[model samples]
Target: MKKLLLGSVCGLGLAAGPALAADLGVPVRAAPVAVVVPGFSWTGFYVGANAGYGGGKFDYPFNAFQRQLQAEAPAIESRLDGRLGLTSGGFILGGQLGYLYQFDNRLVAGVEADFQWSGIEGRLSGTGTLTGTGTLPGTFSLDAGSQVRWFGTLRARLGYAWDRALLYATGGLAYGQVRSHADISAANGGTPIPGLTGGVATSHTRWGWTVGAGLEYALTQNWSFKTEYLYVDLGTSNVLSSAVDDPGNGFSAGASMKVTTRFHTVRAGINYRF
Candidate 1:
């Protein structure tokens, strides 16, 4: 009886072990490998559009302007000495193309070229009181104006990119077209004098340099937004005006004017990377 009982218990243990093993079997497929996405890169070619405001000051010497009248109308020139300076401001619209490369250490370097249509301009008129010998002894007036119709720049940029954000400093060659005009008129006690008016108008293209800084952010995988400020200098231009000649009054004079180009621009833009 004891032997039979022990044999039955061993048979039950073997049957239970096989049932547990089948229930705990391994999975048919391994867990999906973890997917890893890489960080953003600033290496690409891009094209963009921008809009902003531009304004600044200029250098127009009164002495240079008086050169036209100093010889024949010394009295008039002396009276018109120490004249007015110009102030400029306007709207700007443009587009840009660029290429950039970002290093392993997050240092970014690039080159960009941009073209713009500028509405920045300035105009002013000055009047002086004259009471002197052999002079009109009245009021003399002068009018002057300047405008930057268009401009372009080719610049190099260097920056450190913090993932999707970049801060940079840029500088390079700048060129533009400027239009200017100056006029001189006089009157005795506010009455227009005959043959006492002369003026000059000039339009020229000039080249110079620009320096600035900017901040940019990646808005999407292939798009970015940026804002920047630039200080641009396009040099100066000089043109001589027709001399004031009055045979009846024995008054003869000539003038030369100067137009200096310098301005500041603050702009915002969006770019698409290729």
Candidate 2:
């Protein structure tokens, strides 16, 4: 009986061994799955294409009569205003490249460069007759026009960003090339006024400054869309000067033109961030 009881007890303990081991085996658990999420940032480099409209003022001032020929000068000057107002406008298309950085406080800053093909142009003309100048009364006519062919900008941007959207103010160097044409005729009164007929067409590069503001929204991690407005001023320039001699009137005089080009542009663009 003692041997049998001892064997029986050993068998029971052996049978329960696996159950105890299962309950107390080193508790193993998958390391609490570590999860990490990312925040939105506007730090990146980008390239973009844009299309827009441009409009502005093209003013040409010529006062050849103001220069010489005293007798007929005042009479001719009085007959017509020596200004050609070529109100200007047209289409603008371009591409740009830029870099941007976002600060901890959501302040954003960047620099951008762009080149565009522009079709801004204007046309104007005026005609009148000169009388009582002591010479044969003369007929005067004037025509003028301007076209901005291409333009570029190197600008610095400052803005505040809200998650995926940015609001910015920009300003900097603006440059462009223009072609202008002007014609003047104070002819056909042999004794009245010295017959003078001349026209000038010229092309030159202009430099100026631009200031504006914009809003940009990110459409994805690597893409954005923006709308902006800029005011650009290329200052005033002289495009032509003229001189004529008339032994008939015993007077000689010259003509000149002064032009002022200033414009505003509104643009919409899509950008790819790198």
**What total of clashing residue pairs does each candidate reach?**
3, 2
Alpha-carbon deviation at 125 in model 2, angstroms: 1.5
Model 2, 109-200: lDDT tens per residue? 99999998999999888777754444545677778888889999999999999999999999999999988888877754543333346788
Query: RMSD per prediction, one decimal?
Result: 5.3, 5.0
Model 1 residue 138 CA deviation (Å) reads 5.9
Give the distance in Å from residue 191's predicted Cα in candidate 2 to where it truly belongs: 7.8
Q: How accurate is candidate 2 locally (lDDT)?
A: 0.83
> Would you list the clashing residue pairs of candidate 1?
68-254, 68-255, 69-254
Tens digits of per-residue lDDT for model 1 on 1-274?
9999999999898998767777888345667998899999999999999999999976676532221234454545323445356789999999999999999999999999999999999998877764455544666677889999999999999999999999999999999999988886766767754434567788999999999999999999999999999999999887434455666655554445677889999999999999
TM-score, one value per model:
0.77, 0.81
Looking at model 1, residue 102 earns an lDDT score of: 98
**lDDT at 225, model 1:** 99
